[model samples]
Target: MLYYRQHFLHISNEGFIEIPRYIQTYLPHHLRVLIGQLQVSSHQLEIERGLSRGVPREERWCPICHTEVESEEHFVIGCPSYLDLRAEFQIEESLQLCMTMGDQWHLGRFLRATYERRERSLQLTHQTRVSTEQTITEFFQRVELHQRGPSIGLTLHQAAAQRARRRSRMVGYRRPQLYQEDISRINTTYNCMMEQRRTTTP
Candidate 1:
């Protein structure tokens, strides 16, 4: 109910135009914090002085965009610094679309992109794979080339989990007894069996 209300307000009050059909299908239960964060982030640009705590009083500049980091809004939505990094692709347009999307999914996209860009800049230019015995550099090299977003990473992890489940089942592994399967359709059958048990009890 809260999600519906927030989404309703986001679309009606905010300039958000449309919710993509793909995301609408799942219809997540709640989104209060996500909506609040986006609202705050958008408003942060309106502030004059920077909001960051760590910067010295004299050198209060945006670490990413070099502009004076005046407000939470500047750090998030106003600063032009990330545009160069994002310009490697059509990240600016994507970010704009995400901001106006008025949903948590769009916020997730922004967060994922921000994390990826920061990690890419701070970490090695190329992804590093480390292991005890082997560096697995070749495997990481392939994954790095794909350059897909975090969503793809999640898909890969899900695929791996499915594969593991299949392998375990093939090896005769059994889940615990308490791991129940859906039995709603068999309710009548179960009632009949109970009746037979009562009849045969004599």
Candidate 2:
């Protein structure tokens, strides 16, 4: 129990606290499997009378930046790229200066922000897709109305009329509104990044 608590603290202090619960569950399962595999391999080698006794502990790779010497600090928050983002957020100053402690806080903030942006982008894309569906619906409705033959106009006149109708509807299309929302979202994100940078430090 003490080991588990210490392990959990170490992991959490490295900024794993904010990770979604499901992901955290996978960490323990994976760690158990890894240890079990290593132990079995070591026992096999011992039976074969090899020189080596057990599998050695190796350095972990940083999932975020893919650095070679991926310590908890490096993997979670010490990467230069993340530091750059923190710089933009103006929150670097408040970050834990000690590589270990600071990275824990930085990692939590960085991951949370990243997840939020991705979620927002996904929502925007979904809304855009819906808007496109609506536009297609509106276009077909216009076409159906035209086929009802209000006037026996020339080919050029019909083409021009269709174009005009489409344009008028597009001016008020949901896509445009969505685009505006996207612009605001991007601007807000940029501002947040800048604000954090100004506020924080390595």
In Å, residue 166's CA in model 1 sits off its true spot by 66
lDDT for 166 (candidate 1) = 75
TM-score of candidate 1 against the unseen true structure: 0.28
* Per-prediction TM-score: 0.28, 0.26
Candidate 1 wrongly placed segments (more than 4 Å): 1-59, 84-104, 122-202
Query: How does candidate 1 score on lDDT?
Result: 0.46
User: Candidate 2, overall lDDT?
Assistant: 0.44
Tens-place lDDT per residue, model 1, 161-195, is: 88888743556667755323446546768999999
In model 2, which regions exceed 4 Å deviation?
1-102, 142-202
In model 2, the Cα lDDT at residue 84 comes to: 56
